[model samples]
Target: MAVDKDTVAGIAKLARIKVDDAEQEALTKELSNILGWIDELGELDTEGVQPMTSVVEVQHSLRKDVIKDGDRQDDILKNAPESKQGYFVVPRVVE
Candidate 1:
């Protein structure tokens, strides 16, 4: 796709960026080159290539699922300035 100066200016406006008149021409050429490279990539042939997560063969080390409380009730409540039976006491702001 060919990118013109006007197109670059419009893109800059949509992105809320200020592009000088001299800079727009350079940006237009750079965008055109990027699009040309993308077009070239589209011409590659791939008959039966499967999608893969990693290029190298390696398995991720995973641990078994274990659930437990990280903190004790007494330890957590000790830091509170005012703690009730088993919770923190805070002033009510709403009526």
Candidate 2:
């Protein structure tokens, strides 16, 4: 995974980033080093390893689903500036 200056330039063009000759050289080295580290990680033995979302064990508590209309019309309508027939009264938008 050795990144060359031409590869760095192509990447910069695809990303729409302006990279001068000096910056391209620097980025080439950086990208090569990062890929080399990834290659090193690929060589490690990962047998009998379980993939986990978190290091600590967690138990999620869930409640029973129950649906019911909230019977608080008068209490809710009290907060409105104006209400008529158990509904908020707003100015007519259409002529």
Candidate 3:
């Protein structure tokens, strides 16, 4: 986890980040510490723990699927600027 300035620069180049020389030292130390922390986490004991996707359990309340005719064609066409034969009339797209 001991990241040097050269390693930091190489990492920045690989990640397509433009890290200046002044900031590289700070970034190197920060990234190295983060990796070290992740390494420290590997020492934790959780052999019997069940893997959970989320901390809170959620229940989705859903209504029964019912099918019905949504009859609103005439009502909808009433507000149109131009409608003919139960359809909206628009200018022809092709000549």
RMSD of each: 11.0, 12.7, 12.7
Q: Show how many residue pairs clash in every candidate, following the order shown.
A: 0, 0, 0
**For every model shown, what is its TM-score relative to the native structure?**
0.44, 0.44, 0.43
**Residue 88 accuracy (lDDT) in model 1:** 93
Lowest lDDT 10-mer window, candidate 1? 63-72
lDDT at residue 62 of model 2 (Cα atoms): 94
Query: What ordering of candidates by lDDT runs from best to worst?
Result: 2, 1, 3
Q: CA lDDT, every prediction?
A: 0.90, 0.91, 0.89
Candidate 3 C-alpha lDDT tens digits along 1-95? 67889999998999999999889989988998988888876788989988888787888689878877578899999999999999999999889
Residue 17 lDDT in model 2?
100
Off by over 4 Å in 3: 44-95
Superposed Cα deviation of residue 20, candidate 1 (Å)? 0.8
Q: Give the better candidate number (1 or 2) by lDDT.
A: 2
Kindly list the per-residue Cα lDDT of model 1 for residues 1-63, writing each as its tens digit: 878999999999999999999899899999999988888766788669777879899888998
RMSD in angstroms between candidate 3 and the native structure over all alpha carbons: 12.7
C-alpha-based local distance difference test score of model 3:
0.89
TM-score for candidate 3, please give it.
0.43
